[model samples]
Target: IDMLHWMSRAALEMIGRSGLGYSFDSLDEGGKPHPYSVAIKQYLPTVSEFHFCREYVLPKLRQFLPPRVCRLALDFIPYKKLHKLRDVVDVMHQTSIEIFEAKKKAFEEGDRAVRAQLEEGKDIMSILIKANSEAAEGDRLSDEEVIAQVPFRTFTFAGTDTTSNALSRILLLLSTRPKVQDRLRAEIAEAISTYGEDMTYDELVSLPFLDAVCRETLRLYPPASLSSRVARRDVSVPLSTPIKGIDGRKMDSILVPEGTKVYVSILNANRDSTLWGPDSYEWKPERWLSPPPQVLTDARIPGVYSNLMTFFGGGRACIGFKFSQLEMKVVLSTLISQFRFSLSKEIEWKMTGVATPWVKGSSVPKLPLTVELLEAV
Candidate 1:
C-alpha cells in the first residue's frame, strides 16, 4: 500500500512537472490530503451514483414511470442528499479552473517567469499553451477549455497505480523464481557498473533482458483486460481459424452491422496458444528474447506489444506507450536496487473487466508484500 501510494504520488508529480509547469507537491510534502484529493474522492462516489441511476434505476423506472412522474419523483428527492454530489463535482471543476487561471495569470504578468523557474523551465504544458495561443482561433483550444481539462491533465489515477501494480506483480513472480530473479539482478548490476553513475534513456531502452521481463509480465497479466470499440460501418471479420457454431456448422466470419459494439479480449488473446505457441500460458521472458514463430507474427494478429495486443495495435494504440515503458523501467530499477520484495501472504488477486484489474473487496486495494533492504556493495 505504501509503495503503491508513493508511486502514485510520484507519478502524478512527475506528470505535473513534465506535462505542465505546475507541481502538485504530492511527493515532497507526503501528498498531504488537499482539497483537490478530497474533492476527487467525494466526486467519484457522486458520479458513480449518477451513472448507476442511468444504467439501473433510470432505465427500469422509464419502463413504467412516465417522464412527468419521474420529474415529480426527482423533485421529492432530498436536496441535502443531492447537495453532497453537486458540491464535490463543483469543487473539483472550480479547483481546476482556479489552477488554470493562476497559470494564465502568471504567464501574462511576467511571461511565465514564475512557472518557468519552478518547473525547470521546460514543461510540456507551457509549450502546448504557447502553441495553442499562437495557432489560428479555430485550431486552438481556448484557455477555458484547456483549464477545464486540468483534472485530466496529469492522469493522476493511471500514472500512479497501474505501473506500481505491474511492478508488484513482477516482483511477486520473481520471488517465486529465485534463479530468474538472480539472473535479472545480475544483469541490472552489470549494466549499472558498466554504464557508470546514471543510466541513460538509450541504455535503459537497450536492456533487452529487462525489456523482455517487462513485456512478459504485461503479456501474462495485463493491467488492462478488455477494450471496447464500435463498428463504424457494416463489416465482416473472417476468423483466422474456423469455429464450430451452435448449429455445429463451421463458420469463417462473423457479420458485424454498423454501430455494433465489439469487445476485444486482450487477456485471452495474450494467452492464445494458436498465436503464442504451447507455452503461451507460462510466464517466460525467453520467448520475447527469441523471434516469435512466423505464425504468431502474421498480420492476422495485430498487437503493438509482442504481436499479442497488450497495448493494443495500430492508430488506436496507447499514445503513452513510450512514456509508460520509461516510467516502469525507472521505477522498477529504483525499487529493485533498493530493496528485495517477497509476498507477505498468499492471496489471490480477483479480476475485473475494467481497464485495469483490482482486488475484489474495494476500488483501490493494496497488494501485501514484505520487503528487506539490500546492502550497498
Candidate 2:
C-alpha cells in the first residue's frame, strides 16, 4: 500500500467524524471517496509550495496591496499552483456551507434531535452550532463564522496531512530501528494482556513507553518543520542568551518592525543541543525515561504540546494535538501488535511544509515495508 496516502485517508476520516460530525467513509475500500477528502489531500501540498513567499515575501506584498487586489492579481496570473489553491478553497467553502445548512436544519428538527446529534460526538461543528443557538444575541457567532469550523478545511486540516505524515515518519523509524521496534511492541503486548485483544483508551494513555516513543518521535521529526508569523506592530523580543551586536556590544533585545515576517525554526529548536543535549539530533526514544537536565528545564519554552514547538505555542497553537496523539498511539499499537515491519529500501523525506516520504525517482509518496502477519500474542 502507499502508506502515506493510506495515512492521509485515515486522518481525513478521523477529522471528519470528530470535528465535522460527518463521515467521509474513506476507509471503506468499496465506497467512493468524499469530495472534501479529495480536496484536502490536494490542498495541503499547494499551501506548502506557497511558503517560500508566505514568510518573508507575502507580508511585503500585503503592505502595498490589499488582500482583495492581491488575490485578484493572483487569479489573473497564469500560475497553476495559485489557481489550484483558489479552486480548493472554493470547494471547501461550498462544502462548509452545505454542512452548516444541514446542521441548522437538524437544530430546527427539535431539541431532542439536536441532543442526539451532540451525543454522537462533540464534533466541532455541532458544538459551535449549539453554542450559537443558545448564546445571548450579542454573543452568537454569525452563520459564516460557525461554518468555517467545518472539517476538511480550516483547523481540521491540522489532524489530516500534518498528522498523517507524522505517523508515517514514526512508522518508518520503527521499520528501520529493530531494537526500538521490538521494545515498543513488547510494551504494547504486555500492557494489553489482561484487557482484551485490542488496547483500550485507558491502557493506551497509561503506557509509559508508548507515550515516550510518541513524544520522542514528535520532538525529533516534527510534522510542521517551520511556522510563520507576521508582526502586527513594532516590538522587542527578549533572548535567553544575548548575542553581540555589529558594533561589538552585547545585545539583550532586538527590534522587530511591524509587518515583518518571522519564520519559527521548529526542527532546529527541537534538536537544539542547549536544550536536549549534544545527542539531540539522534533518534532515541529512551531519552524520555530519565529526567532532562536542569539547564534545559530551567529555560521555559512556551510551546502548547510539551516543551517543543511541534504543535507551536500561544493562542494559534494546534487545537487537535491531543486528538492527533490518540490517533497515532491507537494506530501504532494496533498495527505493531498484529504485524512485523522491516525496511524494504531507502526512503527519502521531502518537506513540503508537512514532511512526507518520497523515493528518488517517484513523485508519489511511497515507503516500502516488508510486512508479515503475526499470530495473536
Candidate 3:
C-alpha cells in the first residue's frame, strides 16, 4: 500500500470535518483526489518557484503600490507558475468564502440550522462564527477577515501535509522494526482492553510507550525542519556559554538588529549530540521512557512541546500542534491494534519544504508498505 497517498487523503478528511464542518474526501480506495486537495498540494511547490519575487520584488512593490495594484501587475507578468499559483489561491479563497457564507447563514437561521451541518455545528469554524456573532461590534471580525481565516483551507494546507508526512515516517520506521511495532501494538491493545476502544483524551495521552514513540519520532524527524522570524527590535540574545568571536574575544551575547530575518533550525536543535548525548543520532523511542539527559534539560531549548524544537516556540509557535498530536495518537492506536505493517519496497525521503518519502527513482511521494490484518487480539 502507498502510505503517503492514503495518509494525505485521511489527513484531509480528518481536518475537513473537524475544521470546517465539511468533507473533502470519502477516502474510498481508488478514489479521485478532490479539486481542493490537488490545489493545496500544488500550493507550496508553486509558491516556492516565486521565492525571489516574494522576497524582493513583491516587498518593494508593496511599499508604494496597493495590494490590488500589485495583484494586477502579477496578472500581467505572464509567468506560467505565477498563473498556476493564482488559480490555486482562487480555488482556496472561493472555497473558504462559500463555506463562510454557509456558516453565517446557518448562524442567522437559529440552532436548528447550525445543528443540521456536519459535526452538528461543533467544528472550529462553526464555533468561531457563533462566537463572533455574539461578540461586541468592535470585537467582531469583518466578513473578509473571517473568510481569510480560511479555517478549513489553513488546516488542510498546514496540517494535512505535515501530519501525513509524519504519519508516513512513523509507519515506515515501524515497518522496519517488527519487534518495536509488536511492542507498541501490545501497549495499545492493553490500553483498549482496560479503557475500551473509545479512549478519552486523558486515556489516549497517558499511554507511556505510545507517547514515547510519538515524541521520539517527532524529535528525530520534525515535519518542518526550519522556521523563520524577523527580529522586531534590536536585542542581544545570550548564548548558553561564551564562545570565541572572530576577533578572538569571548562573546556571551550576539546582537540582532531589528528587521533581521532569523532562521531557526528545528532539526539540528532536536538531534544535537552535545545536548542529547552520542545516541542523539539513533532512533530509540525508549530514550523518552525516562527523564532526558540533564544536559538537555539544562540547555533549555524553548520548544513549544516536550523540549524539542519541532513545533518552534514563542508567539509564532504552531497553534494546531496539540490537535496534531491527538490526531496522530488516535490514528496510531486504532491502526496498530488492528493491522500489522512491514516494509514492502525501498524508499527514500526528499526535502520539499517537508520531508516526504518517495520510492527510490520516482518523482512522486510514495511509501509502499506491506499491511496485514491482524486477527482479534
Candidate 4:
C-alpha cells in the first residue's frame, strides 16, 4: 500500500477537524476528496515550480510593491504555473472565508448555535473566535485576520504535508526494523492495558518507547530539512566549540550582519557528529530512551524541541510542533497496536520542503509497505 497517499488524507482530516472544526477528508479509500484537499495537494508542487520566485523574486517584490499591487500583477503575468498557483490560492482563500463566515455567524447566534456545529465549537478556531468575541473591543481581531486563521488554507497547508511526511518516515523506519517495531508495540500494548484503549493526552505522550521512536525519526530525517531566517539585527552567534578559520586561528563565534538571510540546515544540525557523537547518523530510539549525552545538552541546540532543529527555534519556532507530535503519537499508537508494517519495495526520500518517499525511479510520491492486521496482541 502507498502509505504516503493515505497519510496525506489522514493528516488533512486531522488538521481540518482539530484546527478549523471542519473536515476536508473522509479518509475512506477511493472516496471523493474535498475540493480544499485537492487544491492543497496541488499547492506545494505547483509552488515549487516557482521556487526562484518564492525565494528571491517575491521577496524583492514585496519590499517595493504593496500586496494588493503584487496580487493584481499576477493576472497580467502569463505564466501557466503562476496562473495555476493563483487558482489554488483562490480556492484556499475562498474556503477560508466561507469557514470563517460560518463560524462567525454561529458565534453571533448565541450558545445554542455554537453548540450545534460539527466540533461543538471546541476546535482551535472556534475557541479563538469565542475568545475574540469576549475580548475587549480594542483587542478583537479583524474579520480578515480571523479568516486567515482558518485551517482550510494556511494551517492545513503548513501542518498537513510536514506531519504526514514525518509519519511516513517513522512507518518506513519501523518497517525495516521488525524487532524495534515489536518492542514499541509491546510498550503500547502495556500502556493500553493500563490506561484503556483510549488513552488520555498525558498518558499517550508519556510513553517512553513511542516518544523515543518519534524523536529518533525526527532527528535522523526531519521532514523540513532546511529553514531560512533573516537576522533582525547584527548578532554574534556563539559556536559550541571553536573552529579553525582559513587563517588557522580558532573562532568561537561568527558575526551575522544585519538583514543577512541565513539558511539553517536542520538535517546537518540534527545529525552532526560532533554534537551528537559519531553514531548520530544512526537511527537509535534508545538514545532518547536515556538521558542525552552531556555534550549534546551543553551544545544548547537552538531548536525548540528535544534540542533538535526539526521545528526550528526561538520566536519563529513551529507553532504546531506540539500538535504534530501529538498527532503522530496518536496515529502510531493506534496503528501499531493493530497492524504490522514491513518494507515491501525499494524507496527513496526526496526533499521538497517536506521530505517525501517515492519508489525508486518514480516521480510520484509513494511508500509501498506490507501491512498485516493483528487479530490479537
Candidate 5:
C-alpha cells in the first residue's frame, strides 16, 4: 500500500531535477514537505474534480476575463477546491519567479559557476530563458509571457503524475503476475552478468524483452484514457470497417465539422479487438516480440510511442515519452533485481486524472504488495 506513495515521491524528485534544476528532497531526506511539493501534490486531484471547468469553462474564462478580473474573482471566491488550486498556482508562480530571478542575477553578475551550469544545454530552464532573449524581435515573447512560461519548465502535473501513475500500474502488474516479473528479472540478470549493473542508455534500450514489457504495459494501461481534440475544419475520418449508422446506412467514414469536439478513446483503441487480434485485451509482453501484423501496421493509426494511443498522436503528442519509458525501465530493473513482490490485498483502479489504483474505500492512492528480498533470479 505504501509503495505507491514512495513511487510517487521518487517520481517527483526525478522530474524536479530533470525537468528543471530544482530538488524537492522527496527521496530519503524527508521531513516537513517542501511547500511547493505539498502544493503540487494536492493540485492534480483538485483540478481533476473541476475537469469540466478546465476543459469547457476555463478556456472560455481565460479568453474573456482579464488577469486582474480573474485575480479579483479568485480573491472573492470561498470555494474549497478553488482555494486549494489557487494556493498551488501561487506556489508554482512564486517558485518559478524565484528560479527565474536567480538565473537572471547569476547571468547578469557573470558567475562562472552558474555560467558553466548553463553551458552545453545542461539546464533546460536556463537554456529556454537565454534562447528567448536571443530570438529575433518578431519571435521574442513579451516579458509577461516569458515569466508565465516558467511554470512549464518543470511541467508540474504531467511530468510527475503521468510517469508516477504509469509506474504504479507497472509495479502493480508485476506484483500480481509473478511469472512475468521473474522473466523480466532473468533478462535483467543476464544483462547485469555481462554489463555489471551499470547498463548504459544504449544497453537498457536495446533489451528486447524489457522493451516488450514496457510496450505491453503502456498499451494495456495508458496514462490518459481519453484525450479530447477540437476539429479545426470540416473533415472526414477514414475507418477500417464500415459501421451502420442510426439511420440504417453503412458509413465508412464520419464527417467532423469545424469546432466539433472529438474525444479520442485511447483505452479502447489500445485494446481494440480488430486491430490487435483476440489477445489484445490480455497482458502478453511476448506479443510485441513478433513483427506487427500488416493489417495493424497498414491501418496507419497515428501515435507517438509504440504505435499505441498511450502517448497519443501527431504534433501534440507527449514530448516526454522517451524519458518516461527510460524511468520505468530503470526503476523496474533496479527494484526487481533486489526485491520480489506479491499482492497483499485486492486493489480497485479508478478512472480519474491519472487512473489510480487504491485499496477499496481508501481515499489515498495505494497498492499493497508483500515485498521480499530476491537472492538471485
Candidate 6:
C-alpha cells in the first residue's frame, strides 16, 4: 500500500513536472495538493452520481416501463441535472485554464531566468503548449478542449497502481522461486555492470530475460481480464481448429453480426492450452526465449504481446506500450538493486477482472517482504 501510494504520487509529480513545468511535489519534497488534483477530486462525486443514475435509478425505472418508454424517459430526464454535471466539469476546465495561463504568463514575461533556475521546463504540457502556440488556428486545441482533459490528472492514479501491483506480483513470484529470482537478478546485474552507471534505452530494451519475465507474468495474469468492442459490420472470425458445437458439428467460425457487442476474454486466450503448449498454465519465461510454435504464431491471433493478447493488437492496441515497458523495467531494476523481496504470507491472488488484481479480502498484503538492503561492492 505504501509503495503504491508513493508510486502514484511520484508518477503524478513526474508527469506534472515533465508535461507542464508544474510541480505538485506529491512525492519528493511533499508538496501540497495542486489545483489539478483538487479539480480531479471534485469530479468523483459527479462520477458517482452518474453511476447511481445508471446502475440503480435506471434499472428500477426500467422495471415498470417498456424498453422504448425507458429510453424516452431517460431522454426526457431534466436537462437541469446534466447542466449541473456540466458545471462540475467546468471546475476542471477552469483549473486547467488557470494552469495554462500561469504558464503562458511566465513564458511571456522574460521569465526564462526562472525556468532556467528550475531546470525542469521541458515537460509534456510545455511541449504541447509550444505546439499549440505555433500551430494554425484550426489545428490547435481550443482552451475549452484542452481544459476538458483535466480528467487526465487521474492517469497518475491509474498508471501507478496498475504498474506497481504488477511489479509487486512479479517480486512475490521471484521470492518464492529462488532459482528463477537468482537468474533474473544475475541478468540485471550483468547488464548494469556492462553498461556502467548509465544505461541507455537500447541497452534497457535489449534485456531479454527481464522482458521475458514481464511478458510471462502478464500472460499468466493480465492486469485487465476483459476488453469490449462494438462490431461495425457482420464479421466471421476463423478458428485455428474446429470445435464440436452443441449440434455435434465441427464449427470453424463464429458469426458476429453488425452492432453486436463483443467481449474478448484476454486471460482465457493467453492461457489457452491449444494456443500455448502443455505447460501453458505454468509461469515459464524461457518459453518466450525462442520463436513460438507454428500453431501459436498464427497471424489470426490478436496479441500485442508474444502470441498472447495481453495488450491487445492491431490499430486499437495501446500507444503507451513502449512507455509502460520502459517504466516497468526501470522501476523493477531500481527496487531489485536496492533490496531483496519475499512473501509476507502464503495467500492466493484474487482476480478482480479489472485492470489489476485485488486480494479477495479487504486486508490486502503490504508485500511484507524482508528488504535486505544490498551492500556496496
* Candidate topping lDDT: 4
Model 2 C-alpha lDDT per residue in residues 1-377, reported as the tens digit of each score: 55676677788777788787887665876666667767776776788788678756888999999988987887788988889998887787787788778778877776676667865557887777777778999999887667655453556666787888888888889888888888998988887686766666887888888888899999999988898898999999999889999999999998999988898999998999999998999988888888877877787877887689999988888877888999989888888888888887778988776788986678776767778888863
Tens-place lDDT digits, model 4, residues 1-377: 88887788888899989888888777878797777777766777788788887888898989999999999999999998889999999998898888888878866866475656633566888787778878999999998887776454456788988898899999999999999999999999999999999999999999999999999999999988888999999999887778999999999999999999999999999999988888998999999978998988988888899999999999878888999999999999999999999999999987766788989999787899999999884
The models' CA-based lDDT, in order, is 0.68, 0.81, 0.86, 0.87, 0.79, 0.66
1 or 4: which has the higher TM-score?
4
Error (Å) of candidate 5 at residue 69 is: 1.0
Mind sharing the TM-score for model 6?
Answer: 0.75
Residues 117-139 of candidate 1: C-alpha lDDT, one tens digit per residue: 53455665566566665789789
Q: Which runs of model 5 end up more than 4 angstroms from their true locations?
A: 29-33, 133-139, 142-156
For all predicted structures, in order, the TM-scores are 0.80, 0.89, 0.94, 0.93, 0.91, 0.75
Most TM-score-accurate candidate? 3
Clashing pairs counted in every model: 1, 0, 0, 0, 1, 6
Best to worst by lDDT, what's the order? 4, 3, 2, 5, 1, 6
Report the C-alpha lDDT of model 6 over 60-98, residue by residue, as the tens digit: 877888877754554456776665555666665565567
Query: Which regions of candidate 1 deviate over 4 angstroms?
Result: 26-95, 115-122, 147-158, 245-249, 352-364
Candidate 1 Cα deviation (angstroms), residue 326? 0.6
**RMSD for each of the candidates:** 4.9, 2.8, 2.0, 2.2, 2.4, 6.3
Over 4 Å off, model 2: 30-32, 51-77, 109-115, 150-152, 197-200
Candidate 6 structure lDDT:
0.66
Q: What is the lDDT of residue 8 in candidate 2?
A: 74
